[model samples]
Target: MGQVSDRRRIVISGCSSGGKSTLLDELTRRGFRTVEEPGRNIVREALATGSDALPWVNPEAFVRKAIEYASESLEAVRELNEPVFFDRSSIDALAHFERLSIRTPSDLKMLGEACLYASPVFFAPPWHALYEQDDERPLPFNEAVREYDWLRLAYPKRGYAIIDLPRVSVAARADFMLRTLGLPLSKAP
Candidate 1:
């Protein structure tokens, strides 16, 4: 295991609509620096530009662009003095490749292995009632479930501890995550 710094690279990851974004917003509101998910940004940009760099259209191109974004996201925090939260990590690209049954590029495989997040990665399991589709996330409930399973296996394979987030109110989830990381819980304003 790599040495963990006090400035943890915490990744909030899981299937779509599982409240990862909600918790990230809460953490950011509480003053922790955060990096948003690049997949949606990439998707929106690709669609806007009429590019074929979508997961379904061109999985390799999609992963390549995602990996690039993820790298930049990581680099953005390289000099940070406080713990930073990431909505997703580079390993997610590999998981997507797995979920899509797409061939994982050797370079992407290496990137996933090289870039690491702190252990006890927060995982938002599929919540059926809360699940909804959007333009960026069109994955159905069943596919989300499968993606969750793949994540459960993928993160651990990369030597991360999968911390399954409870299905609770977003505020409560934020508290739970802070508690899990031994950080003080935030008081309401």
Candidate 2:
């Protein structure tokens, strides 16, 4: 188990375009602190700056940037006392390295373990109906599903419990997450 202070730092991760962002938006709308997905932000920045740190262009560089971004995010929120939901973490970036058959650096593995998140990480399962391709997420549906499969295994291997989010409306999902965390839904504005 992680330090007590870290318990409220929850992580929400899974397949791309699997409603994770929508659920995070709903949580944010309801007044919870939320962290954006590192990968997407990295992609956007890379596209804007013409950096080589893009998943399709240079996966290794992209994952490294993700790891850095996630670490910074964790540090930035360390002082927050309320529940903080993260779209993904360094673990997800490490998992991407594994997916690419790249040798996982010891430092990266240690960083993933060092930056602890609350257990029972909520994973949004692959939702075919909700999945879509956009400028940031260009993976085909099948590839996204494969990524989800990889994530399902990754979280558990890292000693974090996995809870699959139900394929329901974003509001319902937010309620479920709060309920699971033993947080009061009535607190929502």
Candidate 3:
């Protein structure tokens, strides 16, 4: 399978409930393709099916599923010619393994190295005002902050530069990301 170039695959990641989803929604509204976060989908499915593949219930299973979902997401969009935004990627799954003190499988590590995202990965910094607990995201504010810390380190360790998205209106964030990518800004509908 061909790998998507780092420049065309953008990852929007960071703290939980830190507005990554909202920013992605804005980009989608402007007609960009986006991939949903794997954890949220996993949580939703686990809840509906009463499965143990939940982060709190079975973290190992959770991370495994996340890796699978993220990999599939990457593959699904590999052929797209336009910029494709991902809420989080397999690197986030690797970080979760780190958080749990588990050794990453060699294949997972290789996959992380192979699937490159755009440099200067955009991170939504911890936004206390915007943070809210939901069924899919049950982490407390402090834990969310810690996850952000881990991601801040993880992406750089994987050779990606980090760019923290400014705390501003979602539209403004979208415009900033587009401008930073040198893509044309979409006029408001």
Candidate 4:
């Protein structure tokens, strides 16, 4: 598999409750195509079925599902010409495996190594004040910080630059991301 040369396949990843979903929504509202977070959707599905494929319950299963989700999304967008924003990608799954000290499956590692994301990933740092828990997100605020640190290290080690997004309003953050990509900013109507 060849790496995507276009920087449009952006990955906005960070700790839980760091406004990744919100930022992705803002970008989508500005007319950017996006791939939603597969982990959250998997969590929702697990909750609905009372399955053990959850971050807190069976983390390995959760990681496997997440990688599969991310891989499918990546493949689905392969034919698109427009720059598509990914809420998270396989890298996040790898990070999770590393965090848990779980051995990453060979297939998952191969996928991650082959299909690298667009460089200079936009990282949403942990926001203490904005951190909140919900049904899908069981990660606590402190753990979110630790996750951010892990991601910061993980992405760079994989040859991707981590662009730390400033702690600002959601709109500003959205604008910052577009500007960082050298894309024209869409004005709010």
Candidate 5:
């Protein structure tokens, strides 16, 4: 296990509509610098460009975008002078594929380990309250549950502590995480 550091990274992940984004927002409010969810940004861009018309046909394209964006996000966050929070990481892409039964790529396997090896990590549990559907969020409840389960399994195997965000409010969750990581809170605004 690694001791906390200014450069340590915390990765938040869960089912499609879970409070991962919510928690990340709170993390920012509390003091941690962060990386936005590349998947979300990619999906938004894809929807704008109609690149998602054939998700089944070119899922790899999405994966590649996630990987590319994750790399950029990590680089940006690494420039911060404090621990960084990620809405999610490239590892989540693996979990996404596992939920859909797609084969995991060898490079992603390496990237997951590399990122995990470089920082302390966090993951959120799926929260149904935050879940709703859109063209970009089409997984069924059962599938989302399976994706959550698979993600829980996948992350720990790579050395992340799945932060149970089931009961805490977004602010409290962020406070608890900073306390848990021993990262000092920023001065009051």
Candidate 6:
């Protein structure tokens, strides 16, 4: 099949401070339409407004906002005629169900199960070398690793392939995703 014919939705996920944003930037730069992480934007706004400080303090609220954003993000992708990249899809949010000890609603689980996606995600591990934090985020390194594990397994039972992404320069990792997705290259950032 041609690259376009082989097209499927791609989701790049990892822990909270994982390189999801970095990967999203790469994919968009490579000429593929991409859906940015609305959850991050929401959390940033919340923190900026001082509505939510600690991710642990009001995880339920934060997760709810993220779920709403993810639904919108996925709908936009599903409506597209071209392959799209999602920085952190709702499945990642579902993982948070475990990460935060919250139970996922049946409808949300169904949404994740129904969405069409690409094989072999580009997942960024929790890198102590690269992981840092700002005020709104305070997840420790071990917690991030635990989240990473949850992500790596949850999709496979649903038939999506996993592509483990190692820590590398942003340029190289982007190049890897483009090649794996059978997409042409564009500017690398």
Best candidate (score: TM-score): 2
| lDDT of candidate 2 over 1-189, digit per residue (tens) | 865543388999988998998888888888888998989889999999999999988988898888888888889988877789999988899999898899977877777667888899999988899889987888999999999999899989979999989998889999999999988763446
lDDT of each residue in 75-140, candidate 5, tens digit only: 666666566777878787766666677886888656644554234456566667767877667777
Q: Using Cα atoms with residue i matched to residue i, what is each candidate's TM-score against the true structure?
A: 0.91, 0.92, 0.91, 0.92, 0.82, 0.82
Clash pairs (backbone) in predicted model 2: none
Candidates' C-alpha lDDT: 0.84, 0.87, 0.87, 0.85, 0.69, 0.71
How do these models rank on lDDT, best leading?
A: 2, 3, 4, 1, 6, 5
lDDT per residue (tens digit) for residues 142-185 in model 1: 98888888888888987888888999998899999998888867
In model 5, what is the error at residue 150, expressed in angstroms? 0.7
Least accurate stretch of 10 residues (summed lDDT) in model 1?
180-189
The sequence of per-residue lDDT tens digits that candidate 6 reaches over residues 73-146 is 76766656667888877667666776667777776666655555677766777778788776655667887788
Candidates 3 and 4 compared: the better one by lDDT is: 3
Q: How far in Å is the alpha carbon of 112 misplaced in model 5?
A: 4.9
lDDT of 2: 0.87
Clashes of each: 0, 0, 0, 0, 0, 1
Question: Which candidate, 1 or 5, would have the higher lDDT against the true structure?
Answer: 1
> Relative to the unseen true structure, what is the C-alpha lDDT of residue 166 in candidate 2, on a scale of 0 to 100?
93
Enumerate residue pairs that collide in model 3: none
Question: Candidate 5 — which residues are off by over 4 angstroms?
Answer: 1-5, 53-57, 105-113, 117-120, 187-189
